[model samples]
Target chain A: MNLPCIVTALPAESRPFFEHFKLQGRELNGLQLYSCERCLLLQTGVGKLAAASKMAALLQECPDITGVVNIGIAGADAPIGTQLVAGCVEDAGSGKRWFPHLPPLRALPDLKSVVVQTHDKPETQYKNGIAFDMEAAGIFSAARGKLDSSSVQCIKVVSDNHSSLVSAIDKSQVFNWMASCIPVVDIMIDLMADPIRDQVRQVDEFTESAAQKVHFTVTQLHQLHRMTTQHLTLCSSLPTLYGSDAKSILQRLKDELAATPLSYTNPMVKDA
Target chain B: MDTIYIEEQISEHPRTLAILKRYPKARLVSIDRYNEVFNNASQNFRKQKQNPALILAKKEGERVLPTPDQYHIGGQHNYYFSHMLNCIYDCRYCFLQGMYRSANYVVFVNYEDFFADIETITAQHKKPSWYFSGYDCDSLALEPITQFVEQCLDAFSEIPQAWLELRTKSTQIRPLLNREAIDNCVVAFSLSPEEIVQAEEHKTASLEKRINALQQLQAHGWKIGLRFDPLIQASEFERLYGRMFEQVLSAIDIEAVHSVSLGPFRLPRDFHKKMIKLYPDSKLLSAQLEYNGTHVSYPESTEKAMIDWCEATLLSRISSEQYFPCVSS
Candidate 1:
């Protein structure tokens, strides 16, 4: 099963996610890796270079990792507690930019997303229109090549806006912000991981014996999976039918479904 | 309206300036070229959909091309031009979701250039050529913002021999209603059973609203067409489509209707894979499908059943001359 990787710049920023998932923490290559069955939360110390190096290592170690979500406390120009999704992450020093891809329904729908600038240091004065963080560009740039843009999300809740620079911000308050965001983070994890879990469940339900007998190619396997999932959801659970191979089974299923009477999945259809 | 990314070349374009003025609140960022952002790797189709950005750029190369002959509706020398890429509606069956990496809407503001290309193509044919406006995007869904159809109507008017088809599932026909209906243009509306529309065709005008719009357009002397194209598969579809036809035929004068086209739901294998990945849980995508060569669709028997039933139901009402069942799509 492919699991989502969660990366945070600081251990403090990673605490709430760790506490929420109740992950057993371990250290690999001098970086902390906290994980559960569905996800792994990796904490990179500080700054862009650290974020990039640690993220690169984490993905290298977990080659099957599906996607990554980079979460941390960020200083934005908005209210102190405003939650923001990063639409674009710009590295200020080199003027490089990465538009972090977010999945449609998988993201927290109502949060405001904005452009974020990753700086060498915290900005106390330049705070009228965007978000300033130290790690998103690094994490995104590193994870981007290994994943699709939509699968990598860089999101944050405000710890300090224009009120204070990184130096004057309270650590405990950042902890509270991180702690409160646990529920939202959990929701994201569920949205991202549910498809993976469902796919596994489907494979389990499909029966390995029949699969081995059929010797279906990759495309045929996916086609069967798609048909089975739809049938289970809209019509009925797939039944064991007599067939010599995968092709026969698919054809038999088609015959069965075609013979079945019309049943609409959407309730509005019943009304119509 | 989400954030909009601008290409550096088109930042100073007059049309781009007008669009930016409309969405004053949207964050505008500049990229070196349109593809730099639109073609970015690992972009999630579903996530970007929630807050899709608007990418404004200048379209280059082959502005107009021949439509796959299978998509014809009694037009000679059929060609389609897209002022935009991707669409506003999130229809589950649309091929656009799989065709592009990003769900964001990209509008090429160079209207004059597209018309100029059409002008060149029109001169090549002795018979009137057909220009389809909604191949890549809805014809009128963004009419209020782009006002492209309004401009297209004017451009088509100059070449009276050229026919324009603004195919859409949009109820935004005020621009057409406000002006006199042009004889050369056919405003085609896509139709399906309300059950399928509700289940899969998200953010489109309802069946009732579309019929109402068609009735209004007919009243204004516009020639409309019924696009039962991409006919979706479901249980008891005949009963559903039967009732739909009764409602639709009863609503308008079939004689005034320009034509009717019926094509089964089909997509290239690669597009289907992309769509399945984007919408893992979509029941419509999961329906019993047959992989035929490079494309996938309902099994031949099932496809025949759908088209045969619809044809029997429809041809019984309208003449066979005006009805075209697309053999393959």
Candidate 2:
């Protein structure tokens, strides 16, 4: 199965994109459908924290998501009307930075390697020398930790500048700005998503048969016993997100399955 | 259960002597003094030889010391401590094969001396210190046999400022659960994707099992850490990691997690060479990697990309303060 390439956007930034991709007249949760290409793009609300949480939720819901891209209007260092694909995201509060997995910017020399910094207020970008964004950092951070780095891409069009023009930019301007760059967004999405989609398909093919095969030895079973115990130690360190009953059921399954000696007749008893 | 025999030696090293004093009850099996059983045939797991593991014991004035790799765990503090050698698990890429002359485990029964020396050094330094276990052997792999973590936890608990980081791929948490959680102790588990764990990290717990164990400990109020060091670059790494992260987050509560550290695959140049020699056919060790000074690591671009991805993902789920990148100096 091909993992989805999730896109995070606000109500304004999402409307036009959803309209552009709308296929039959059906809409799901304010998100319109494109061709059933096995990609899931989500409108993860606005702001860094919300975007981060939404991205996490998306990843949890769709473990097969091949890649992630955060598409929005960014306040670039260049002219207010300029278009640029952000190559990295920097957190202003923390010196930590994230380099998005876009195609190498070698061909686009005019495009600035924009750093998208996140803050509580839009005014925080005055001190930093780049674009201001509410969600890129959160998306980048979430994608980076949950997925491989090469699978995250951030494409932002310059909607406003660090100048007083930033405050003048309203919700309508953000939508118009994102709408104008629909073509560039399409290009960026293809560039970032195509390779990852191919890779995910390959992984699915490989793991499918391997997942079906079950081969474990008695010695391996003994080792699995020790491994399960150690796994219990590692899990015990984390807080409980699920119910204790679920945890116990999973543990019991692991114990029983891991303890079962691997015989040719028992196809279920196999190596992980 | 193959056993490799060893000859005995008496050393005057204070730490070695001190350890021997604690293990007065341990039997000392001896071979010829001149025929140093340092590298037995069965013990050598070098790539060229496929032999059974070895088991060795010695009689000394106070300690039974095992030969340990000098700098096994790198990054925070340079430390070398080994209560035992060799793990119960037979990971294909493990350095224990090349670094050790034998695959047999050598458990130093002396605990008091190890603690004494640790206390002495800890007292000397005012800065918060870190003592790493699971270098020569997994700190908790053989918990049922030796109950080593129990003793070490007791010793580390006494020192207020000193920190003890028990690194392991094992899921043995019974001993940890039995004791009171220590403030200065951090129980860090080495994690990999389910695919990597199944293929390369042979004899290790499943990813789900490990996560469950981590969750249990966090619920019990233990400060737990996630170590995604030595991340293997596999096909569809993003999907693998994405699923892994989702699985972890859904199964684990983010608030209780103390810290998460991510590092790409790394190995000392010498250790890499030795490991390659020990496992010439190992796909993991044979992967294309560049040598950065004395260590073999992923290419700069790849490492940066992987680390960047992991850092971002972790920050989204947890606070930035909780994420640590194990960068080499």
Candidate 3:
């Protein structure tokens, strides 16, 4: 099963996932491009707009990327440290709300469904509810119209109380804390890989079938000729069974012969 | 000349009708006419395409003239005056969209009636009165045609106690630059972070362009005001707003500024519901919101947090006296 290419807005947020996927290469830009046996990881920047742009660039760079999982920290109304899997990302600025599909997280035991309100700042804890951090909203907004909703997920760990968390932690500590959430990242990556691979297989089968229908080999053409001969023999017998019906059957036999797959060996053959 | 399209001619109740009757010379075109005007490419806003009826018919409103929530303007007795009906900019959260049916610009060209009413209101109140423009539409957005602000400034300059505030997101300051800055008038600009402006405020001037205009206005000695109204929720709001405030303060002379007002995402309940219906897919409108009486504002705690944070952050640079929380009264 091919796992999704996991992208994080913050390098610290992507650390655990990046560490899990062994680095296979580096880009000319000097950013390390890592690839595990099943997963791919790229660092997106902070905030909704920045994160969204990065995710888009990543998708363009890797069109084969079937699924995108945006992982990071969020502020919640629940207990400060509780983890949440965002079901929706609401842009507080534009009042646009997007619902994401996370089948893997849904299957988990006691996984909480949350609506992450993306704000310009870390909201101080209000009675309304927990608000998630910056990049998720941008990531979702950018991805919503671009990526299939079924293939995008935002999994976040509660990093702080809205008010105190911003003040208590230094920049480095926030990065370290994000780096430690690797186990959760691995499980989400593994969960999504199977479905993506299955989708690829289905697409491959469809492509092959479409290609075969438009192009025929020598063997297929020969087989088609044998079938036509049998069909003609049956048409020759139809007149004895029903007089007028034989005429219609003969017309159908001619149409079928015209529609038969042509051999590629013919000079007039067209590419499918 | 931009053709005015009127979708419907609703005869407002007697009181409202009386106000319209005062402007007997003002033309009333059918609503279909507006659709035709908007359908033209040259007449449309640069942002998003226009939708909904452009003009809204309101019968006599006792508060047709709404009192500007004073606290919002740093204790100024602010009264918002709308000369036109709708805004050219299609900001996603604008109340005018929800409050009115039409998207066409309705120019109540009977500048005489509006000025007469303002004269009466100012005479009744002896205090220094600040009359705000662009409450329902951008004051200078369509100034090329309307010339409403220019007329109002001319009329209000005669009244020593009357102050006109042309609150807008437009860099159309040519009207103001053409004339002397009315001592009583403060040309305020509604500013949002660059991100919000690009993503949500369709057709509004860019923050950089707006700041440049503001700097020019300040250099010319025009009284300036900064409005951070309807702040959006985002992960980097503080950094964005803080940076925005810092940038404005640094670019312009702070002392020449009139006042600064900060508000959160808030809408009147009816207006909010109407806006939501207008934009069912709008992420800003659909977010969970609690009603604070008739006002549909963010939850109290969220509102408080946002306001308090803004106040604290703004106070660090400007004095508390310079800041106002245009709270619902």
State each candidate's clash count.
13, 41, 35
Candidate closest to the true structure, highest DockQ? 1
**Relative to the unseen true structure, what is the Cα RMSD of model 2?**
25.5
Ranking by lDDT: 1, 3, 2
lDDT string, candidate 2, B91-127, tens digits:
7667676676554456555567677777776776677
Model 1 misplaced stretches (Cα beyond 4 Å): A1-5, A15-24, A27-31, A36-39, A47-49, A60-67, A71-85, A91-96, A102-134, A155-200, A204-227, A234-262, A265-272
i-RMS, each model, one decimal = 4.4, 23.7, 28.0
RMSD of each: 4.3, 25.5, 28.8
Where model 3 places Cα greater than 4 Å from the true spot, the runs are A1-272, B1-3, B6-77
- Tell me chain A's TM-score in each of the predictions: 0.70, 0.64, 0.65
Q: Write the per-residue lDDT of candidate 3 for residues B3-25, one digit (tens) a residue.
A: 12233444343432444454343
The TM-score obtained for chain B by all candidates, in the order given, is 0.98, 0.81, 0.81
**TM-score, A chain, model 3:** 0.65
Model 1 residue B49 distance off true place after TM-score fit, in angstroms: 3.1
Top TM-score: which candidate number? 1
Interface DockQ per candidate: 0.35, 0.01, 0.01
* Error in Å for residue A227 of model 2: 35
User: What's the lDDT for candidate 3?
Assistant: 0.62
